[model samples]
Target: MPSFDIVSEITMHEVRNAVENANRVLSTRYDFRGWKPL
Candidate 1:
């Protein structure tokens, strides 16, 4: 038997930052951005 408590919080600032980074990467990659999904 194991008892444990895990508490965590992620700020909106961090989430927004990660999203922005991903968008930037996507925008800059011409192949991925221009390619059509099949």
Candidate 2:
């Protein structure tokens, strides 16, 4: 059997890194082209 750990502990660098990665991925998302925030 295999197991995975969904970490509950994170550092500021990790959070910043994740946000940067998400921004990079979303930047190329066609559906997000005209998306607006509320």
Candidate 3:
């Protein structure tokens, strides 16, 4: 039998940072100037 711990291998901090960065960029971009995602 084999087992794996996939959840332990993922970095949530990095994922959150990337998402925040993307949101910042999108918010400042001309096309999405006033767009906000909630």
- lDDT of candidate 3 over 1-38, digit per residue (tens): 99987655658999999999998889789998877678
What is the per-residue lDDT of model 1 for residues 1-38, given as tens digits with 9 covering 90 to 100? 99999999999999999989987888789778875435
Q: What is the TM-score of each candidate against the true structure?
A: 0.60, 0.60, 0.60
Cα RMSD (angstroms) for every candidate in the order listed? 4.2, 5.0, 3.5
Model 2 accuracy (lDDT, Cα): 0.84
Estimate every model's Cα lDDT from 0 to 1: 0.85, 0.84, 0.85
Q: Write the per-residue lDDT of candidate 2 for residues 1-38, one digit (tens) a residue.
A: 99998879879999999988987788779988766545
Candidate scoring better on TM-score of 1 and 2: 1
Among these predictions, the greatest lDDT belongs to 3
